[model samples]
Every structure is written in C-alpha cells, then in structure tokens.
Target: MKIKICFLLLLFAFSNSFGQQNNFNYKREIIGTNDQWHKLELPNEIFGKISPNLNDIRIIGISEQNDTLEAPYIIHSTEDQIKNVNVDFKLLNQSRDKNGYYFTFKVPTSNSINQIQLNFEQENFDWKTTLEGSQDQQNWYTLVEDYRILSINNAHTNYQFSKLNFPNANYGFYRIGIKSGEKPKLESAALFLKEIVKGKSRNYQIKKINTIENKKRKQTELDIDLGSPVLINNLKVNILESFDYYRPVHIQYVTDSTKTELGWKYNYQTLASGTLNSIEKNEFKFSNTVAQHVKIIIKNSDNEALTISNVEIGGSVYELLVRFSKPAKYFLYYGNTNARRPNYDISRFSDNIPKSITTLALGDEKIITKSETPKSEPLFADEKWLWAVMALIILILGGFTLKMIKKTDEREV
Candidate 1:
C-alpha cells in the first residue's frame, strides 16, 4: 500500500510540472477604473518577449469576491482606411499625330475622378504625358502637364510607374496625350477616385547600418539593426544618386542564428520585395512583422551601385480593444509558447463596438515565476522495508532446504 501511494505521488508531481510549463512568464497591471470597454496600446518592449502572433496575451481580472475573470480582446493595427470608387468612361477617340499619340475618354455622368492608371503592352518605354479635362471637347483645360511615365523590362528588373494622380476634377471629357515618336500600344486604363484616411504610426530608430558591395555577385547588401525587435510594416530607402536607375531589391529579416566555427550564422526570411526605382518613391509596405535585424539586397547587375542616403522604418501602432464586465483589477499576461490563439464572440461583433473608448495605461512589468511542486518521498528511504523483504526471502529458502533433506532421508531408509 505504501509503495502504491508513492507511485501515485510521483505521477502527480510530473503532471503538475507539465502544467506549470505552459503558464505565462510575465504580466503587467492594467491601470484604470471600471468601464464597459477600454483600449490599451502595446508597448514596443514586449514585442520581443511575446509570441509573434500574440496568441498568448491574456487579460485577467480579479474581482472583489476573489473571482478570476478573463477579458476578451481584439488586436487592432492602425492603418490607412482607403475607399475607392470606379468611374465609368467610354473611349471617345484614339488618334496619332506627328508629335505623339492621343486618347480621349467621355464620362457619361460627369463624375469627379482624381486618378488614372494606364497599362501598356510595350516591354520598355520612357515617355511624358499631359492630361486635359473639359466639358466641351473643343475647349480643353489642362489639369496635368509634363508628367513622366516609365517602364523598364530587362534581365535584371521589371518595373513600371504609369499612374497619374491629380486634384479631383469633374468634366464630361478627358484626354491623355503621350509624347512619343512612334505609336504607343495602350492596353487599358482605369479612372477612379481614391479616398484615403491615414492612421497613426510610430517610427523605430535604426541603431546601425552596414553596407557591403559584393562585386562577384553584382549586388549591394545592407545590414540594418533596429537595436531591439519591433513590429514594422513600412520601409523607405532614400537613394543619393540623381541619374535614373531601376533595380530589383529584396528585404529580409533574421529569424534565427547558430554559432559556427568562425562566427554566428544567421537564417533569414524574405519580408518584402520590389523594384527600387528613381521614378517613384522608394517606399515598400507589407504585412506587420516582428524583427530586429533586417537585410536589403539590391541587384545592380553590371551598373554602378547606387548610394543609399537614409533608411526609414515604421509601422502602425497595435492596440487592444478589451471589454470589461464590472469594476475589477486587471492584469495582462503573456509569454507562453504553448498557448494557442483565442477565439471570442467579440471578434465577430467588432462592428458593434463603440467608436470612442477610454485608453488605459499599463503598469510596470512583473515576472511571473512558476510555483514549485512538492517533492515526493523516495520509495526505498525506510531501512525497515528493506530488512523485511530480505528476511522473507531467507525464510522461503530455508523451507526449501529442509524439505529436500527430509526427502533424501526417507529414500535411504
């Protein structure tokens, strides 16, 4: 019975240890009074410690009755709100003059539009364009003048910048003129009004940048360190060269590293990729990623390497929209690898949430140490049990020896 009890205790100890392994490692107090809902902006310091998907984040509240309650939350990333409206237009005329080519379009409802995207079948071209709007085709008013449209298609880079943006203009007729020696093959065009509502963002300071030119590979590589891991989505590369150039660039981040004989070898994953061109703003936006070390590779091919003047990295702020039931003290816990992402009804009904919410501040971070489990006593610790087992074995051997002696004596008689 004692041995059985000891075995059960050992099993219980192992189960408790496994449970504690999944417990949160860190927590912070949510400092605010009772409210229906509250917003909390996540601090940058916690990005490195928490899970990349933020699945382990939990808002736990303790009530006056000593009851623990979990508050459901939704992670929100502040980003641009864009609304686009496509305007219907019919091609009125397409003609070519000695200087260039012209295409005219007529809007039926005379809706206002501020942007036009032009697509072409040509592999490469560099041309200037002029846009004019008018209610009567005979009398045209110039809206945009001497705008450049560029496209480059080669072994190294494939890029195009053919979008025309201007102030909203309402007209019955719109005309586009391309300054080209030969006829231009126009594939399609789109006219639309784009409304964008920019959101708040925070810029991360880059601590150091190291540039290296790989002459053998014909590439320029930049190693960037942001001091600490941060959630970033946007990056801008400023070039110092004045001449026109287009190059394919790839952005990557370090995911892990290993120690080799010479130094630490890093494994990187691509975050974003696009063409770095002089015609457009060299800005690239991608999904939010948590990273500390980033690498940029520019394919220069046979051309001279372009000088980089500055690099800017930033992202939208992450906020938690939490709903509270009653007045209670709440704490945020995170840093658990075993935790899965939570699903709550509030996520489905996010539209019902109030537009305005009171933001709450967070207290100092505290480390949550796991509770120690009780140690079970050893099964063979008592000397009495060892002696008892030894005496029982001796008694069985002695009985067998006496029975064999009696059998031998009976056979001799």
Candidate 2:
C-alpha cells in the first residue's frame, strides 16, 4: 500500500509537472493552543467559536433567541485519529427561539499556508467563516474575509488562496470562523466535514459568490432541456394470464418531461379487487374492461418536452394518430409472467412449421394412409364375377334335365 501510494504520487508529480507549473512549494502548517500549539491541529477553530481540540469541536450546539424551535447539534471525532472525520449531524427542533440553533468550529493553520479546502454535508444554511493568519501570535492578517455559504445539502465548497492566504512570512497561524443563517426564531442546522488533504490545494469557486458568504458553489449544474411533446400509440395485452377489465394503469403526467419530474402514480380506486392490471406508469389509471387499447396524443403547451410510460391495453391493436413537433423514441413494455417482459424472443415466432404438423417421431396418419392405399383393378380384367355367372347357368340346366328323366321312368312303369 505504501509503495502504491508512493508510485501514484510520483506519477501525479511527473504528469502534472509537464503540463502545469509545479509549485515545488511545500510549507509546514502550524496549529496553536492558548498554552501550546500542536502541528496536527491547524485552524484551531473551524468556523470559529468551537475549540480546536478535536473532541470539543465534534459536539457543539447553538441556541437561538425567543423562538420555540429545536436547536442544531454537532459531533466531532475522537482523539486517536488525526484524520478525525465527523459522520452525521441531527438537528432537533423543540421550541422556537430568537436565534436558530447553530454550531461553529475553529481551525488552526500555519502562517505560510495560503488556502484550505472544505468538504461538508448539509447545505441548508449559509456557512460563514473568517480567517486570521499570524506568525508571532501577536500580529495576525485577516487572511479570509467574511463568511461562506454552502448551499445544497451533501455538497462541497472551495475557499481560495486570496481569501484564506496568510501574510508573507515563514511562520503563520490562522483561525476559521463559522456561523449559520437561521433567522431570529430558532431554526436548526446540522453539518459535518471530512478533511481530505491539507495543503495549498486550489479551489474552483463560483465567481458570483464571495468567499465571505460561505455558501458553497457547485462545480456541476444540472441543466434540463425538456424535449418536444410526442404522440403515443400504445397497446396492452395480458399474455398467459387471466385478466378482465377493471385493473387500473397509473399514468404519471408531468408538465415537463425531465429527470426531475419523474414520479409515481397509483390506481388503487380504479382497479377493482380480483382484477389485475399490468399498466404501471405515472398516476392516471386505465380500466381494462372499458378500454383494451389507448391512444394519447400529447401536445406540449408548456415550452418543455413530454415523456410517457405505463401505457395499458387489453392485448389488442390500438391505432393512434400521433402529432410530434420533435423526434421521440417510444418505449413499450409488456407484462409476460407478472414480471416486466421484453422476453418474447423474435426467433420463437420465425418458425414456419404449421401447428398441425409434428417434427417428432410420431407417425403422421394422413401421410401413412395415402401412401399405403393399393392401386384399384380395372372392371374388365376382373375374372371372379364372370366365373360365378357361368357356374349358376350350368346348375339350372342340370336340374331341369333330371326332372324330365324322372317323369319318363314313371311312364314306363
């Protein structure tokens, strides 16, 4: 691990050195106490008020004036770790007070130090901090001006060199002051910080906000371009499942079809008990009995784009005339086994073999009967009937002759 870290550092040094000018500048950071200063604990008070001692800074609570709201609480790290990191902060509001509850921390630093980077969670309130850098402890330069506001909870803020940089000298000292903007009534604010690397790290801050605001400026902004409205021709079918109309499909309709507007819709009332509807989307539910196929032509009156899903049908073809000012891709999903299906393999339908025919070894009766039939004999060539007729004539003639002979004998007697 040590070797790997060293290798990574070397790689970074080499790569960064080529493209960017290397500030071979490495300086010692100094941490001070009223009695004696420690090298590890720089910026004695982070955002002022709280002790530089890691333990004391961990748990600090601020009280507001005559408002009956709960106060914000802070928790610091244990002594054993220099990289003392705070994890969670819970703000409990009881009664409203004049000033909203908040906490502050003081950070000690070296006089030679230029800037500090702060990574924090909880962006509700404006975080304010002031820096005073000193060498002899007697004279100090107001290194950081005003307070910084960190907005958008679970985010980070970068304080620059100009605001937090100490005066030019060998030895330096600094202080960090913090305050929250919870109005007269005691609102609550909770936050925590993890120290990544303590050095002359550069900060990319929003140009509009001053370092004093302590309000964090983010590096990335979410820009949504809602596309044009699209017409949807969707059909739904219950395959291999016994379903009747009365199952409801929820359609989540949003004014702007973007990531932000993505939400859920339920069709509890529309779906009758014992009925199972497969259509699942936003909020509006469709009845299975009334409509098997539904066509929706969505036009965007709002300048934003529109998206649709959870189209329901009763396994039938629905003809839809879709008008689209913009290009859109339609996503259709079918439920196969109570599970979302796209499982229908196209290859399964490609076999042309008729259903009546079997590919297995089962003998085909139709083919066997046709092949086994013997050829019929011609009528003239059959001798059995002619022979039977000849025998019958002979017998009749013999009987007549015998009868006459008997009569002649009788006359002689």
Candidate 3:
C-alpha cells in the first residue's frame, strides 16, 4: 500500500531528526593556568553561560574527581629533574672530526645555568650534539641545537647518556658538539643543578587479566591486572627470552577493603633487582597504592618462570588545575556518557585557584535550582503529546484514503 505509506513517512522523518532535539552545545576553550597549575593554554574565543538547563550540568571525566581542570599542557616530558650537581669542569680546547670530536669547556659558575652533565664512556650507539654558551669566549650562545647522546650495550644492559638538556644560563663559556665520531672517553663534564618537579600525574588506565584459573596458577603467579582501583607509581614489564637474566623480583599489591578468600589482599611489598641505569626499565617504582591486583612474585631469584611476555601498567599523574581569569574563554563540556562523578567543591585546590577568580561554564547536568522536572514519563514524552501523535497519524492515513474513494463511488453505481 504504497510501501506502507512510504514507511510511515520515513518513520516520522527519523523521529523528527533524532527524537525532537532539545538543545545542547559543545565547543570548549578557555584553558589557561600557571602559578604551578602548569601551563595549559588556548587563550581565545570565550563563551560560556549554561541555559540548556537541567540543574546546570556537571559530568566531568579524565579521572574525574571534580574541580574541573583541563590539561597539564598535555604532560611535559623530556624526562628531566636531574640532580647530581657538583660542578667543576675545564677542558678548554679539543677538536677532531671525521664524524665527531669537538670540545671546549669551562662551566665555572656562580649560579644561573640551565644544566649540563656529560660523563662519557662511549661505544654503543646513538649520538648527536651541539651545545654553546659564552660569557666571553668571543660572544657565542646557542645552547644545544638538536642534542641527543646515548649509548647502550646488550646482554641485558649497559649505558651512556646525554639527552642534551638546556634552558637557563649565566654563561661561563661552554661548547661541545660531538656529532658521534665515537671517540668518547671524556669522563667528567658535569654541571648539574636543575629541578623541575611536577609529579602526581600518572597515566595508563586499563589492563585487566584474570584468566589463569589453573595450570598451577600459571606456574607461579603473574597477575598485573588493573581494571579498577588505581593510583600507581610505575610498573612496565614485558620480558621474553624468558625474562633475560638478572633476577630478584617480588612485588605485590591489592589492598583496599582487603578482600580475602584468595582474591584481593596481597599485603604489599616492593623490591626489584638488576639493571637500573644500565637500563631494563623493567620499570619499577612504587608506593602510591589503590590497586586492582598486581602481583608478580618471581622469587628463588631467577630461572625459567618469568617468561611469557606481557605486564604493563602505569598511573600517577596530577596537576590539571584549571581556573583562569584574564580575558576568559573556557570549555570542556563532557558528553554526559552516563554521568557519575559529582563531588564538586570545585575540587579542593589546596590553595591556588586565584588567577583572579572568574569562571562560567556551569554545566554537567542536574543543577536545576528548583522547579520543573516531574513530567513523570510517558504520554509520548509530551510535546503536546508529540503533536497529538502526529495528528493521529495523519488522521489514520486520511481515513484510509477516504475509504478508497467511497469504494469508487459504489463501483460507479
């Protein structure tokens, strides 16, 4: 019958374009902060007012503990915060090149240096450098233009480093640009005194494995599952070749309500052995708590058990404080994907949300301030009963096309 009247007018035009749209907006911007909330900027196009109503929206996420912060400049990392500063270097002249070798140093300072630490002992690979500074070495100042120097030996690990760090200076003449000619034997070129400190922001949110029901419990314990209960420091282990030598591993976790019956309650102990700087990052750093189950007891120190590669978990990151006020324009209105995380006291900012206090984007649903919110479901979710059931389905398809034109005028009488 005309394809059921064209499929009921295309299902009432796709339910009036997705269930009679009400209205909600999303385009957020207005992320500026510092004073140690750590630079997170956008600085333009500001608009926020909350009127699509519903008690003023509040569903935030990204470890949503509330107090709406935006970003910590997407987490900075050149991996630094070095401290081995003793200072004392004076080589002053050396040059050789076919691929590498150039030196001229003197880091005699009274204070005001970015940072430098080049304790060499080559032959392993990866090098690239160029560093310059001068208080009067005839006026020069480049200070690391593409710096990278690294060395590593196998059989489990051996190391050398020079990630060429820089950014701060008073200059007492410094210059070293060894583009890896592999003649590195220069031992002491240290001048460290740099500390950036901004820790509490961990990232690595999912990894759950609870399969091993038996097989002698997968032959001696191995469960780094973290599906919930997080706040960790570090643990990135993925070994194969049967866990490449060097043993002494005993780490355990799972204690929140302290579940028993052989489930969650591993007390808590940490100890890792071998290859720290000589690298193996079998990554181990602990003491943060709130776990979902992380136990890898490979004691008896070593041997054919720590095999089967895979065990990666990471967490512990903070500093996402967003409270900007100068020429504002902020946004981050979550999609209300179910919503549940509202303990807002603006998230107790231990003192530092005053860049002159000014914010407006109060939305995350459920902030109605009273009145209207009890239509009590049904009646076609009333919009005047959805236009009276679309006018009684167009008058029952126009009374069945006028009763088929009165049966063709009674068959032409």
Candidate 4:
C-alpha cells in the first residue's frame, strides 16, 4: 500500500509539470497612399479625415456596401465636385440582397483618360464591369477594353485593365458601371490612377519594399530606384542539391576573420534565388576546426567589414566542409552494404558527447568509446514501463506472502 501510494504521487507530480501556460500579445502597422496602400499592418485603426484641395480620392479593401472602412486609413475629397474616382475592393458580403461601396470623385473635364489597377486573388466566379465617363452622372460609355489576370503565387492573383482614355480632353470623371452579377468572396484589392502632365519627370522612386509570397500567381512587386544599386560584396555558397526534395538540417561554416555570411537563398530549382547579407559588427574567418555548433548570423548592413567561417553540410553520414559561421560539430553517415539488419541506424542516433571528440592515441579506446557505452535509447529501452510494472508486481506478491505467513502463525497461537 505504501509503495502504491508513493507511485501515485510520482505520477501526479510528473503530470502537473508536463502541461504549459499561455502569455502572448499581438500588434500591426500599415503605410501607403490612398490608391496604392502598402505595408498593411494587422488590427487596422480606421481614420475619418480628408484633404481640402482634393484632386482625387480612392478607397481600398472594404467588405460591406456602405462606407464602413475598417482599414487603416480613410480617403475623402473636400471639393464640391469630384472628378476621377476609383475603388478597388473585394465583395465580402455576397448574395443579391447587398451592394459593395460607391467611390465618388470630381474631375475638371469630361471624356479624359483614366487607368485602374486592382490587386486581388481570384474567386470561383469572374467579376466584370464597364468603364463609364460622365459629367452629369446620367449617360455612360463602355470605355474599358477587357480584363487581364496576373499571378503572384499559388495563393494570390491580380487583375488589371484600362478604364477609359479621352483623346480630346485633359481630364475627366470616371466610374465603373456595376452590372448585376455574382460577387466573389472578397479578398484584398487596391486601386490605381494616372494624371496628365506635359513635362513632368516619371522618375519616381520606391523607398521600401516587402514581399507577401514567393509564387508566380500573385508574386509581390516592389518598385525601387533612388540611385545606383547598393554594392553588397558577398561570397556566394550554393547547395547544388535542391532544398525542396531534401533539406540538410545541419550546416556549419568557418569564419575566423576573412569571410562574411550572406544568409541563405532558398531555391526550388535552378539559380534564381534571393540573397541575405552580413549585418553590423560581424566578422568571419577560417580557422582550426574542433568545435561543435553552427550559427548563421545576419550582420547589420551598416558594417564596413565582416567575416564568415566554415560551411559544412550534413544529411546523414555526409558532413562536407564548406564554410563556417562559428565553431561547430557536424556528422553525416549512410549505409554501405546488405548485411544483417544494421545495428547502428544513423538516423536514430545522437550522442550527448560527439564521437569525433574522442580520438584514440594509438589503438586504445578512449573512456568515451561507443562500443563500451551502449547507445542512449537502447540502454534503457529494455527496462522501460514493462520492467517497472513487473518489479511492482513482484514486490506486492512478496508482501502478500509475508502477510499470509503472519496470519497462519497468529491462528495457531
């Protein structure tokens, strides 16, 4: 009884310590123009103000028919009469009972050229609209030619089309004639516009760029051109083997003082890939190789000089020296022949102290020899829960036998 009581207590203690608790928080930030919203941070805080001398105003990403824009920013025009207006939004509310949003703008003239760019993912059904140029808001023209699809990745898509172009006028008011049709389950969408000027320079530049996905369906596009491309001197390391098919979890490189790590550029195939460069105050060098850990550090970009170390790759028994990040231990192994079921399955083995650390002076097995110290799992496998249950049963049987003998003695007395 005492032994069982102690066993129950031990189990209870282990169970209590096994589970985990939660402590987490979240935040987001967004920045961009009215039509070209970029860097959308999550948990968007909506705004409700407009510029006074408004030439145009475009709103993006709304769900309902009304102007309930829960996005990060709000857009409105101050002028009594608005001209060119464009709204790129996904139809979040479906069915014929509801409408999307109405985009309003005032233009100086009628029958002017207008362009619309909408970024969105495709739905099961296709969405079509007619481009209409109007001054009195009654008669409309089908100016838009057709729709074209742009793929970013497997997950997203973009649609683009020319709205209307006026050969005579310098500016005009335009709106998309919403025909009665089935709306797509709304995804992310944005608007685009073009203004007419005689001698303005088209050399506008992008300050920052970020990618959402890495596929072809809706590949992220960033426009950047300030000056010449910044020169980031680098030593390129290519894993000839494709990562999609097989990934090497263990890679070590040596950088004492000469080399710098430009981080990994993952490729599904061929040479097309991205690049990660050294960050600040980091150096790399090649040196005496006796350590057992590898780290890939992205040095801050503001540094003058940085070094990278040995690069080693491991799959199984396949550790090959290439470069270094720091002191590291690497091991790889593979099968050789068709012998009796192999005793050492490299896949299932990891030594607390790496076997390479222990070397024989002549022919003497070191104190840390693998043959003497059995592999970790095997040493304790045979005597797991089964053996513990067996020991408990034996102890209980012995105690019962002792009790029976004491009872017999008492009855005789």
Q: How many residue pairs in model 2 have overlapping backbones?
A: 71
Compared with the true structure, model 3 gives a TM-score of 0.35
How would you encode candidate 4's per-residue C-alpha lDDT over 327-347 as one tens digit per residue?
212111111122122222322
**lDDT of each residue in 68-112, candidate 3, tens digit only:** 233212212212243545556678888886866878877666666
Ranking by lDDT: 1, 3, 4, 2
Best by lDDT: 1
lDDT of 1 by residue, 121-187 (tens): 9979999999999998999999998999988887767788999999999999999999998778989
Select the stronger candidate by lDDT from 3 and 4. 3
Runs of candidate 1 with Cα error greater than 4 angstroms are 1-22, 372-413
Pairs that collide, model 1: none
lDDT score of model 4? 0.28
- Please identify model 4 stretches exceeding 4 Å from their true place: 1-113, 119-129, 149-173, 177-181, 184-413
Name the candidate, 1 or 3, with the larger TM-score value.
Answer: 1
Q: Candidate order by TM-score, highest to lowest?
A: 1, 3, 4, 2
TM-score of each: 0.84, 0.17, 0.35, 0.20
lDDT of the candidates, in the order given:
0.87, 0.28, 0.51, 0.28
Q: Model 1, residue 388: displacement in angstroms?
A: 33
Candidate 2, residue 74: the lDDT equals 21
